[model samples]
Target chain A: MANTFLDRTALNDLLNGACFLGGGGGGPMSGARPLIDLIVKEYDGVTLVPYDSLDPELPCAVVAGIGAPDAATHGPSFSSAPKDAFLKLQAVSGTTLGAVLPGETGAMNSIIAALVAAQLGLPLVDVDSSGRALPTLSLAAYNLATEPTVLTLANQPVTDEQQATAVIETRTAPQADSVVRALLTTQAFEQEGAFSTWLMTAGQLPGASVDGTVTRAIAVGAALREARAAGDDPVEAVNAVLDGQLVRLSCGTLTAFSSHEGGGFDGYTIVLTDDDGHVVTVSAVNENLLAWRSDSDAPLAAAPDTLAWLAEDGTPLSNTDLRGLTAGTRLHLLGIPAAPILRTPLLAARFAKELAGIGFFGQAPRLD
Target chain B: MANTFLDRTALNDLLNGACFLGGGGGGPMSGARPLIDLIVKEYDGVTLVPYDSLDPELPCAVVAGIGAPDAATHGPSFSSAPKDAFLKLQAVSGTTLGAVLPGETGAMNSIIAALVAAQLGLPLVDVDSSGRALPTLSLAAYNLATEPTVLTLANQPVTDEQQATAVIETRTAPQADSVVRALLTTQAFEQEGAFSTWLMTAGQLPGASVDGTVTRAIAVGAALREARAAGDDPVEAVNAVLDGQLVRLSCGTLTAFSSHEGGGFDGYTIVLTDDDGHVVTVSAVNENLLAWRSDSDAPLAAAPDTLAWLAEDGTPLSNTDLRGLTAGTRLHLLGIPAAPILRTPLLAARFAKELAGIGFFGQAPRLD
Candidate 1:
């Protein structure tokens, strides 16, 4: 696989196309777009390396924002926070950083890693910790094992210009999730935060990450654009580009949508009525965790499968983007099977309780 | 000026005596006493080094509990959290820790340094970051400069029994304060947390810490005990032991006392009516920040100064201890001028805003 140089033009394509690939999480593109544009315009181009080319021992930092996607709309928008987190780890560990990987596959987080790679002059690894956006840190591939996932929060209060960073080192993924959640609820953090996690090496990338996610996201995004230009449904176009199945779950007019911010995340419950007069309820704690008929024991889809939403024109909608949407807005729902690494019994057992805690009562949807 | 070995007896005296010196903060004695006793008994007596006898270049870590003193009543009662924090600093910095200093002077924090020292077989430096307990991290003498303060929170959850450690490294005191406050508000940390902070060297102690606080606490506590035994006034004995003048602010029955937990500290307001119908109000965010008499524009005492309360029998009272007291209970109030270092404009200015934010409407008291 040849490395692609993402200049301003390719950067624009990735930014616009990645939103649909975000799987209804990854925050809204509006918050991160301008900064991404500015950085890409200034730098010659960002190098997007394929997974096979990375040296196993080369250290890489996974960067992403961890807060309500809406919160990123205010400030620190796609700035040096990710790069600073990477440098802080390097400075603390006395090790040099060699690459950058997005913490998750999302329109915003995915490209932010590219920006970091450009700023640092490092290769953007074609892999990510999560193949799609995940609400909690525990739901990721790198943390499924016993290795300590180090999380760094770079929160700069608007009132106090002093940027504060918190590094949480924990034994388990759940513990890291709890610590990150705690940081979000604290008075000092302004109710939201951004973070970089799973600092590891290229050698560990194969085992620690969902391989070749960047290329897939870019390809799907480009396909979506081409299909839309040719008067074809982008859903079908994305399906052709992605390896996993992207199933159209339902088409409906949203009858109701409501959400509240708590425990460092926005928990939302939405009701969409299909043309057949069937109502489907979706419950999400940050990401869309589960969806089921208004009257059913089994869920149509449950985490760690990817759940996504789109507008009539096939534009991807993040939860933050959905906030502006009204009860009568027309939408399309899609569900994609999770990556093979996320389907393991070990990871499923860990996520079962948290999913159920947030009103996900059904068993995890597995595609063996 | 020689270093004293704190045997079982001195450790007991220090533990009991330090509670009163805590100035209504530093957590409660109940959570720390047994742990203190166990460590001193097991070790060949902890070494307590006076500032004058120590080499200034020997690295020291200031240790204390960072959460609500009352919350320590639950599980994780003096686990290996403190020692773990010390060891983490050693591991990260690759510097051998030679001494320990209390982050603040209080019932629990005052003695936690001794416990850490005993556990590590290091000397306990007879100095503290603050001469007495102050609520916010920014109020300490050591943090007045732009030096980095490395803070670690070792919280062992009651449910999981897994210890979660958060390490925050920042350039300024306020940044460290914000980071620590965020950690407390996070779900990973319990409602209250204990931490070790400001890892520095023995040589930096002269410039960084309020000098001889451990010795001062010991002497004041010993004086109180002696006064009670000799039927003399314990308050007067404590006054003579401290260098600054101790003023008897009021003698009154507590009319009303109420507080609520917010932003990781207890914000409290109490009113006391003297026999002559004079009402005095004290405001505290963890530690008493200001006290004012009714109809007086000037406060009786303010932050940086030591404002303390005791029972008529001279038992030192923590805010947690005060919570259990009923209305109309008789208590004695004393105001001790702050240590000279904390009274400096540089440190006082840093604490002014936080004190005011917690309803304390007075200047930081100065001792010229």
Candidate 2:
């Protein structure tokens, strides 16, 4: 109640948190600002009920539009093709949402939740199915709990609709992944693919899937703000709160960072040598696949472990925006575990496979 | 009738044409093939109907799935998403589909049209809104007639009968685009960030909008096939067919090109010195966004003008593959006027102004 009614500040905090949990994706102040501003202007800070306290019986819908970031960024006029799918699922399952559900914990997902909730007049739930980034719907931890395939997908501005054929529905999760991959292949060819990347899974939609990840993100963001205001290293504060460490490493400028290169990012790698006769390396192609420490014998972080790389030298490196990485450029390598993402369909073994050509000094670590 | 009476080999040619028409963004041939194959398998190539021969009074629906390509590309399972939206739209408009309509020229779009036509017992139209490739439905030429804002987006799976709000009726294309963009932001932050790039648009769906880009592409492709069978260079043959010429450019190897390093992407410039000592320098960060004769001040193929880059030497580039480019390479640049993409409420001068930085070169080209 306080977060929504007591203060309007929560929206900003939530959006920032959403961005972090976005795992290099999702919207934040940039995307959420417009919607939030509109809400404040029109409704004067509509009190959003927290997911924990919201009534489950209320007939609300989890509204989400899934597609490519380029489509959303370059072509914002096309209504995402997935919202219609959500509605159909609601109708078919006889489940009516009293509130809109956040698809993930990222800033974009959280703010979208806020926007959808505000638009539909449903209280927003801070809960998201995947606490971290994933590749498809089957990766939803709640997949054991919900339908593997979404009910419907539609684009309002585009005026198009699709119904998955018999081939897509009956397939297994990985098989489904291939189907989605095929669809993406077309988009990839055109460099304009867009569709629902995250899925509701087979289980998880109703109960177990709903976690207040957004709330957690907001709180962390608020604390970071306070820490920054206090002249404290915001990174350190974030590290402490997230139960991680704050380390500074300059591993040359990023030579190449890819978002559209592979499935679920498949993780990325940064090549650099550290001081003190150490050749340190970090890879976060998809969800921080792994990290190699100074000594080749030891693994810093591995698949199933979550790792985030920030510019320890104070240069921000969100989602591998490494366009002009050069030799001798200072960069920080934040090694976090990959467990957060390992929860999805992508396994540590797969991560190992993706980085095979790159050849690591040590054996790839297994998942928890 | 001859074209419709396609054998396996002929169908492959058609698919190739469709792929070219798809403008590098289309789904796997497997999904599309089976649908046509199923028709052929069951009916032994029942009288194939061309778009011109379709019954004018017959109701039709342009269809394609709007979700992560990987997920939708699954083996084959019908879900509720697109079908729900399709049925809902059919009911809302009080118009039933007389035939299957393809929204764009992409290979998948054509296949989707064929699949729906085969399954629904409708004829597949040969016309498309765009004669070339575009990212959104708003770019379709159909919107040139009336900028319809209210769009009914839906998703229907093969088996589901339940349909309701799965169809979204929006009053404005931008509004729908906004909602869909937000939804995609959620999905990208969650998983399918890379794949969720392609989408539909108002201009794409409604009017003469690349209504049958696929069919036309197939036609062009057929010409190329003829040229190839006759041992002519595919490039020269295609150039002649499109009323265009193939300048040298390679996507696989970016060449000695560095145009700009802002936003993202390895921005670079391709320098081509014509035999006349006339130099044309093309710059691009991703796809060829701008092309101009560098020696002179005149603009080359601008924004609305679509350009396809070739790989090293003369390898034809598939728009879907990103690996088409490598380091330190020679290339060719082919300039083609953007197929007619009808202007929509969301994509008029105002929107074009916003996108001016990309240098969309062509004026809103009109078709005969």
Candidate 1 structure, TM-score to reference: 0.50
Q: Which candidate leads the pack in lDDT?
A: 1
Per-candidate DockQ values are 0.01, 0.01
- List, residue by residue over A206-234, the lDDT tens digit for candidate 2: 44464656667777667656775787765
lDDT of 2 at A1: 37
Prediction 1 global C-alpha lDDT: 0.73
The CAPRI classification for model 1 reads as incorrect
Q: List the candidate 2 regions with Cα displacement exceeding 4 Å.
A: A1-8, A26-73, A77-85, A91-94, A155-171, A187-207, A243-286, A293-299, A312-317, A320-331, A336-368, B1-368
- State in Å the error of residue A80, model 1: 51
Q: In model 1 chain B, where is the ten-residue run with the lowest total lDDT?
A: B359-368
Across B1-368, the per-residue lDDT of candidate 2 in tens digits comes to 33355445555566666555443344434445555566567644422455556544555555554333323344353222333444555666666656555555544555555555555555555655466444444454545543324344443323344222333445554445444434433422220111111122222344445544544565566776787677766667667766664443322234233333222122345555544545555544333444544233234444445565433333333343323345544444555555434344444553343223332312322222
